[model samples]
Target chain A: MLNFDSQGLMPAVIVDDETGTVLLVAFMNQEAYQLTRESGQTHFFSRSRNRIWHKGEQSGNVQDVRDMFVNCEENSLLIRVKQHGDAACHEGYQSCYYRRLLPDESYEIVAERIFDPEDVYGTE
Target chain B: MLNFDSQGLMPAVIVDDETGTVLLVAFMNQEAYQLTRESGQTHFFSRSRNRIWHKGEQSGNVQDVRDMFVNCEENSLLIRVKQHGDAACHEGYQSCYYRRLLPDESYEIVAERIFDPEDVYGTE
Candidate 1:
């Protein structure tokens, strides 16, 4: 049996299926695991935010859980999610990861910007 | 001036610019902030993993950081990113934000599976 630290929460990597895009990653506690298993929708326990969040709660862009795999160590989870909507990012972008490391070990922005944050979050 | 607790780290949401996909979310310290600012690429501090992780370091799928926004509270950071390569999720899917909530408040898998994890991670 897998001994999970529900309070501690486990690490999970969320990935995109199409266009090979990675959407977002977060932690999953026992409650989240049970919820995810029961619901099949992506559920995460926000550490810094300290809350249980379901992707696309605020926005219509929801993450649909497809399959799950537990690491051999049984400490981490790799979740495959199918994204819906225009932009999963609250900032109005297609992905949260929009940076790349160049050959010189430096990074550069390669992808195009999609959404305006002011419209999404109602910036001040 | 914003009094940031570099040690404590700050919350960051990573999102895709295309198809409105959310890739991954992680924390960033002062150093990481500077690095990302200088590089224009996404960098994060893995809390549970306890290490500095550059997205797409292992896999070819790299997150290209596009723009950044600081929350009104001046605590959290919302980052815009562009994704390259296929299936950011280790399980090989279009997005990590898969699954959908039905009208019955139940969740269901909506997207099709694209890749096999064994091919990507190399099964044990």
Candidate 2:
């Protein structure tokens, strides 16, 4: 079981510890945090839209929480989970942090893309 | 080109505007801010490890920044990018957020997993 502050909100990131893969980052409100605590699942609060949005609610790319850790400060947290989608990224890729930066101050795309957006989300 | 506040650090999230794909979330320092402004690339400051990390420096999954937006409060920012990997999430899935919460307060995995952890990062 994980302990959460009474503040009712914590910054969290889902990471693949073995490969150092960062799945996604979001905040958890009291309900979301408690929900995640009761169940080994990942939940997040959408700061942009200001709503309680569960990952893969519509896409079926759910995160099964395996473990969780709070930072030394306890202000933020990290969760390790099992992903159920070919691409956790909404854009049809595995990781959201796919792009790399160059020493020259530029950046480039490096990861293999999976799932055609047209097929997954349907064409506009 | 993007302008930076004197504070030298800005919160940012890269998203695919079309599909509502949240590519990644990270902060930007002044140097990283300038770098992204000069070049259409995504850069972030790692608050955890406390360092400057680009999206796909090692994995080659780079983010090509297409657009940038600031919140109404201007405290946080958003970047629209083209991800180059099968999964932008480090856990070998597309998104780091891959879980859904049920009405019963439990959660479940819903997405399709892409790469096998054993193959992607080797066994424990």
Candidate 1 structure, TM-score to reference: 0.50
lDDT per residue (tens digit) for residues B6-120 in model 2: 4455557666645555544566988787777676677777766678777767556677877654432344555677777656655565554445444453445555676665665
Please identify model 2 stretches exceeding 4 Å from their true place.
Answer: A1-9, A17-19, A103-106, B1-124
Q: In candidate 1, which residue ranges exceed 4 Å CA deviation?
A: A1-7, A101-107, B1-124
| Candidate 2 colliding pairs, count | 54
DockQ each candidate and list the results: 0.07, 0.05
lDDT of each: 0.62, 0.63
The candidate scoring highest on TM-score is: 2
The TM-score obtained by model 2 is: 0.50
Give residue A12's error in model 1 in angstroms. Answer: 1.2
- The residue-by-residue lDDT of candidate 1 on A39-60, one tens digit each, is 8788778766888888778766
TM-scores, chain B, all models: 0.76, 0.76
> What's the DockQ of model 1?
0.07
Query: What's the residue-level lDDT of A1 in candidate 1?
Result: 30
